[model samples]
Target: MHAAVGLALISLLILLLLPFAHHAVLFGAEGLGIGTLRDTYLIAVDAPFGNLAISGHMLAGAVVTLLAPLQLIPWLRMRHPGWHRWSGRVITLLGLVTGAAGLVHILSRGTIGGWVMDLGFGLYGLLLMLACVQTLRTARAGRMRDHRAWALRTFWLAIGSWLYRVHYGLWYLATDGLASNPDFSGTFDLMQNFAFYLPYLLIVELWLRLQRRGV
Candidate 1:
């Protein structure tokens, strides 16, 4: 029953992520001159480094979004421990790549919403990289309990890009785009810049606390 539930959730997550991943891959390719679907705003013709950084972030983020959830399936970890270990390594590596590239882009080109968005996203990237490092460090030290806690944090951050879009989509559908603008400097936009990952991370921290308390 647990396996079934896990599979169902993972499947749903993949389904929701399919389009986002596809777009990321395509956009990344285009930014790198592998394709012609370029958006000048995202991939400036004059800024190769910034383009590369953002493109790499998107591509790695797409893969992380797809793979992170599989790492959580209890049956997969119990039955195929080797798979878990190797996949964890890939996820951590890509998570760092995603975070680093994002930071690079933000620092180089900045976000459309100006310094506020840059600050919010910059912090998000820093936290993501930190989680990835902590996850790997704990695992390497054979600290399984600490490893699991960091791994859960890593998973949430791995899919945060997707969650950011999901939050905007729901908000637009409910309010017809209140407190949002193309520049992404509106009140809701400002809140959303940090909301997608911070709240989730906070919840994970709470859950970890409960586990520690035997609650």
Candidate 2:
């Protein structure tokens, strides 16, 4: 059941991000600031460094999302260990780069929730970097079990970007669209800041504990 849910979420994220990846490849950062999201991308475009960070975040995010699901499939690891290791290394490096770039975006541009949102996402990026480092360290140490646990934690946090959008889409539908809906903007902003990432960390902690107990 958990595996099925994970696959569904991964597929959903891939579907959502694939277009952005193509747009980025074909048109680059200039292509992103359009439609309802034009303002956000415009803000990033205003500053040279902001453009770099956001572009790096977008591309690296797409790369990690593409590689992440494959890492979780047991058969791939068993049958093609070499590919798994190489891909894992690439994912780890890209994940760290993207996390740092995300934090840069949050701190430099700010967000709808202000400091609260910045702090929430800032910490999420911090946690992701820590998990990525620990996963790599454990892998180098030949501690496969610990490495796998950290890798899963890293994967969960890495997908927070996609999960946030999913949760926001559901909320948008519940409120019959966010168009001219200023009342719920604050609430939704706050929720999106923490909803997907924090709970996921807690759940992974519990899963690790249960696994240790042979559950």
In candidate 2, stretches whose alpha carbon ends up further than 4 angstroms from where it belongs are: 1-28, 31-46, 177-185
- Residue-level lDDT of model 1, residues 1-215, one tens digit each, is 58798789888988998999998998898888896865468888887888889989988988888888888889889999999899988888998899999999988888988998998899999998899889889999999999999999998988888999999999999999999999998999999889989999999999999999999
- Model 2 lDDT per residue over 1-215, tens place: 58677667667766776664565443334434433334343244456677677777777877776677678866568789998899988888988888898888887876556787788888888887888789888999999999989988988887777777678778777885543244335666666678879999899899999999999
lDDT of 2 at 74: 69
Highest-scoring model, TM-score: 1
User: TM per model?
Assistant: 0.96, 0.81
Instruction: List the pairs of residues colliding in candidate 2.
Output: none
Candidate 1: list runs displaced more than 4 Å: none
